[model samples]
Target: MKNRVEILAPAGSYEVFLAVMNAGADAVYLAGNMFGARAYAGNLNNEELIKAIEYCKFHNKKMYLTVNTLLKNNEINNELYDYLLPLYNSGLDGVIVQDYGVMKFIHESFPDMEIHASTQMTITDSGYADFLRKYNVTRIVPARELGLEEIRDIHDRTGMEIECFVHGALCYCYSGLCLMSSFIGGRSGNRGRCAQTCRLDFNYNGRESKILSLKDLCTLDILPEIIEAGVFSLKIEGRMKSAEYAAGVTSIYRKYVDMYLNKGKETYKVDKKDRNRLLMLFDRGGQTDGYYMRHNGREMIADNTKISKDLGEKKQYEEYIHRTFVEANPKIKINGIVTIKKNNPVTMSLSFGNIAITIDGPTCETALNRAVSREDVDKQLRKMGQTMFELDTLDIRMEDNIFIPLKSLNELRRTAVDRLTDAYLEASKRNNSHRFLPCAAHKESRNKGISVHVLTYEQADEAVKHNIQRMVIDTEVMSGDEISRCVELCRKNNVKSYIGLPRVDRGTYNVKSNSDGYMIRNMSQKTKCDKEVIADYCIYAFNNYAVSALEDYGITGITYPLELNEKELSEMDIDNGELVVYGRIPLMITANCIDKTSGNCHKGSTLFSMLRDRKNALLPVLTCCKFCYNIIYNSVPVYLFDKLDRIRIQPEYYGIIFTTENATEVADVFKCFNNRTKPEDNTFTRGHFTRGVE
Candidate 1:
């Protein structure tokens, strides 16, 4: 039979790491002191990481470091290598990465290292997975929303190892695409500080509820289907959880995974008591199967059961888990031989697996009182104490009149054990120097192409009058017939057409328009497109390599990230980069509607509503009742109209997003950009285009 599936667990802290290992995890993922998505977690420093790597290797378990957040240009150029070198040298099993720039840097600098595409990449189809294979990415933690059929399709086509989240907290918005945290306050989730505004109270009409709060995902019952679909690793989400949570959850999943692999599928079942424990660990209302079945369903949302309080006496076992894990024997047992002579130094030779270590004790002294006995040698050598090694066999030879001090023997035992530990660790190092074939270069059309992303036809009409080459419209805004008319009108004028898909694509948009392409928010939407796919800015293509990778995945054009400044963007040398010259930044996207929270669940309302944060900045909320999600745009538009002259050099196209702007306001925005007029303060913003996030 094939090897059983991996039971992957989260390690928030060192205690959690030990607990998870003790509970039986094949692998555990933890963030280090830098570039981790779980910034608030007690991420290990370089020293702690060394210990972690050694611990995993000693136990024959895989340890993947999380370098999963988006990094700015300065951070990439200045700090990435320094942060990674020691870990790489220490034999880190793999690195989970989100930023394309970071991945490219690691791939180029450390070719032998195993790279995993983070779930933040939102990989949805085989086309994208196969494309990422160029970077030698060994595995992909696909978006949490992908279904069984989609996962199987990706596996059959790409053959890249797929890791799916079997159990954990769920994000209401698609990961990476969410900017709600960034714009609302300045805490960017991509940088690992999500305020979790989604968990806040939002209402539908008169009823107040935690609409954006999603139930935790528990897929125990669906393990067989998941395994059959070719998921190489079953991941558990919750790096911000407790040690007891880690031990309990991991143990439960470990048991099921083993039972299913050992017995038949017919005998597989989730114990009732275990299920309740899982619920108590953490869940909203209760657990859902996640989007494994489908997307945009009411069953996935939670209106109550906000906090998961306690686990009765089971919580007390957390101490036991930590104590047991730290005390477990090394997976690789060592055998040793000791020799003592009258004058020469006593010699000890230790062997572990195929490797051997030898150390000499202090010069043997003649014991005038008592010669070193066989029992004395045995006692000293076998005193392994708290070390990770266990002396499977200890053989000693002493010459007549030999006198070796017990202290010298103990010192020899410690030295031999230390040397053997290093020898054991050396086996983990690999020379995975992967070779990459050169990719051909390409160019973008530097046509000063001004494509207006409009949510309304009034803005569309104004955009057509301007030098707009393309008019990207939200398909949710108009009916199929009306959108077709708008597409026809844009064609009647000289503009090309593209439909703007939502960040988390739940269903195919009913766009009967004769469109030229799609401006896709995430990779999952790429599968539904028949024409050109424009990788949206939310895809976070900050580096040339990332843009190239997306292009290889069938994306024809790209929108560079808003997080990059003008200097950073210009250096990227993107083949078909679309600079966001203008638009209000979308602060956050949520499944919770503010209008509903404000006691106005006006489902049919297209009117713009606003949510005032503590700072009194009005955040515009657009209800997408059809998709069961909402778009929360920032209070002010990012006006680079003043920098059009400075931005004239790079990117094939310069685009503007038109949200909530009337026909009059649209013309003013175009005029401002066309003539390089600097819009006044309080009316416009220069979001992150000048100052990047840390």
Candidate 2:
């Protein structure tokens, strides 16, 4: 029979791992004690992780480890190899990875291990998926913002396995692209320490609400459609939740999946009780269908006023789950045979599925006291206590009046079971002897001058008046004609002109431009333009390995990561890097439009709005209708005029980005950086230049 869609579940602890597996999860994705996106989850240690791997292999299920966070240079270089070596040797099924550097290291050191691209990689297009193909990325968990049609297109085009979240809490900002938590409180989502800043209340046009909070996603009703869209694995998202929640949710989804596979979609239907049970487990007010059916909508936001399940119902459900899946430990069934003769040594054989093993014991003597009966041999062999295996059938073959000590029979049974277990574990073990080499340091080069990224023509005109190296015109904000005029203006002033691509490309934006190069945010945008591509900070060249990886793609220059402090940056080789010295850092690039959610969407028009935090700080929100996304900028722009003296490593280019600033403001900020003077106002932030993320 053909295989059904795999049901993937999350397990924060070893107990939860067993619960989900027993509840019918085909595979479980979990984290070790380090480098996981859910840093606060009760992650397993190295020893427990090895045991989890063995359990999965014995049960014929799969296990995937979550190495799905950006790794710092020291962590990836010094610590990662020793951290992953044991699990890799013990036959870890796969690794869900975010960092390009980590993927490269794992692929080289453990060549047989499969790599699943984490959703934190922000993969949205097939072009990017195709790019990762060379790195041995066998599967991709695309950004949750992608629609079903978009998902199908990716699967059909690249033929890469697609894993998607069918049920979970949703993030307002796209995964891997969020800096709100990091910028706000130094708890970076990229580093697996998100503080859930989006769930906080923000005032939008005098209305105080959790505007950025998204409802939990529950796609039980649309399972058939998702499977038909070529999703190879259906993932449930709640590693931070309880074991009961993991098992309960897995059981329900497993029921429906089996229903759909056994009896066609015509008979696949979720009962009301099961849906209510999911809600009783946990929810953010209520749930939404997510971006599967439609893009973004106001309905997708959590309604905090909605009624929640009572304590009694929740307690009852948890009890049921514990009794059903947690307490009940599923055991492997094996057939056994015991042979006892007068002169020959006593022997026992055990068989499970395709594997069979036999053990030899002490010789059987003549009748001394009482002859060993078939019942005696069967009783001793059936005593498989505390072992994973349970005897389904036991056959006793012996000569009449054969005397065998019960102690010898017990030893024979124990030996047979031990050999079977060793065989099972040995089958899963791998022999990867490859060694990892350190990434080579980049050669030092001369520093390039200042470059400006402008979102408006007024800022562009003001930027060209100064002595700058290059100018990047954002195509999402400026028209083709306006961009062309700006390019010509830059050329006339002896400045190289580059076109800035949209943050999220749905394959609608035109890439045709007569310019020096393209400044791309994602990997998919790299293939769209043939010009000298300079990667934006969103591409995340955090470490030397990542820098080397991006450079191997023929990228000309890379932007320094905004989350890193100056000390961290000093450790990295920044010869071909650009440091953003001035600008409002983009906290979030989201698919949900702030304007449309507020009942005022100007079709294909650029608009500005303010999101007032509880402290009365106004964060600038840029609604780019043309690209159909919103960019939430930090309240204060980063001014490093005085701090420039503290930076030890000088990058190739000093970048100045203009987002909400007008021509006059842009000129003032530019003058401060150029003249090496501090701004009079105290509204500027030093950003992550001082305190780096944990």
Which predicted model would earn the best lDDT?
2
TM-score quality measure for candidate 1: 0.86
Q: How accurate is candidate 1 locally (lDDT)?
A: 0.77
| Residues 1-694, model 1: lDDT tens digits | 4457888999988778877888899999998889999999987778888888998987779999999988765576667887888788889989999987677778887887889999888776665654466679999888787888888887888888999999988987777777777655567888888888767765444345565678889999999889999998999988988877887889889888988899868888889978877876666787889877764466677747455567554454545544555444444467989888877888999997678888887888777877778988888898898786778887777787668768878888988888988888887775544323233446645656887898887788778888788888876566566677778878899889898886665444542346888888866577677888897888887666576567667788888887766677766757777888789877666555555645467787555676655455676777877665678788788877777776534777788998888999899888888788887544777777777665
Per-residue error (Å), model 1, residue 185: 1.6
lDDT values for all models:
0.77, 0.89
Question: Residues 5-118, candidate 2, lDDT per residue (tens digit)?
Answer: 899999999999999998999999999999999999999999999989988888889999999988888998889888988898899999999888888888888899999999
Q: How many pairs of residues collide in each model?
A: 5, 0
TM-score of each: 0.86, 0.97
Model 2 residue 529 lDDT? Answer: 90
Worst 10 residues of 2 by lDDT: 439-448
RMSD, each candidate, Å?
4.2, 1.6
TM-score of 2: 0.97
